[model samples]
Target: MSDKPLAPAIEGWHTMGDQPHLIGTRCTACGTYFFPKQSHYCKNPDCDSTDFEEVELSRTGTVWSYTNACYEPPAPFVAPQPFEPYAIAAVQLEAEQMVVLGQVVTGVDTEQLSVGMPVELVLETLHETDDDIKVTWKWKPVAA
Candidate 1:
């Protein structure tokens, strides 16, 4: 359990150890779905209404892209490192037509990663501070 604030943007990723889910908002008029859930406005560009409601995103998706972070990202991301490489990946939520990116788990084989490979969400620990811990969502290959 990370000491991080429970951000709604990552509700599914940092789970209570259950199936993970992302937050989303569906435009009632245009039938468009947005991740990070737009609660006030529609971004369809086709809809002119300001009505939106929050919904849970699909738990399952596919790997859209992947890479490794060889160097530390600039400040605000608090992970002290000797700069060991870490895997980062983008997952595509088919149901929402959206993508979410995060750091993949360590000690796993990533060479098999391919676009369109099935993945499931997981709660990933980012870093811990004295005052707060930060957590984010991640995706990995689904188990048989």
Candidate 2:
């Protein structure tokens, strides 16, 4: 029983911590960064090795694209009783060579967002319960 809050994700699994993190996969032949992870096999067509190693991703990235969720998400995702509009965006991690999509933090002014804007990842609590707390990733515009 650790003092840390129990994560909504799998328990006992080490948390990614406060820093923006990205998943990385080494080609074994030619190193390459991968997000969402290539668990099955390497995407580098030239190599057939089934071996891969996980690596932490970058914290900052540039916005590749963005959209607003005018409606509430369906199913198991719990939201506030009245519902609120949220923003989702795809951030391109140049170092990882991949695009990671996540919800924007609350109070963001959508009109101020733009493509190619610099952003950084932040860990936030989405929901909580007596035993578990749902945590997810979010992105915010970099401070000027």
Please tell me which predicted candidate would have the highest TM-score against the true structure: 2
lDDT of candidate 2 over 47-130, digit per residue (tens) = 776777777777889999999888888868778768888888899988667788888888885786899999998766676666
Candidate 1 regions off by >4 Å?
Answer: 1-16
| Pairs that collide, model 1 | 12-21
- The per-residue C-alpha lDDT of model 1 at residue 15 equals 43
Per-candidate TM equals 0.81, 0.83
User: Which candidate number maximizes lDDT?
Assistant: 2
- In model 1, the number of clashes is 1
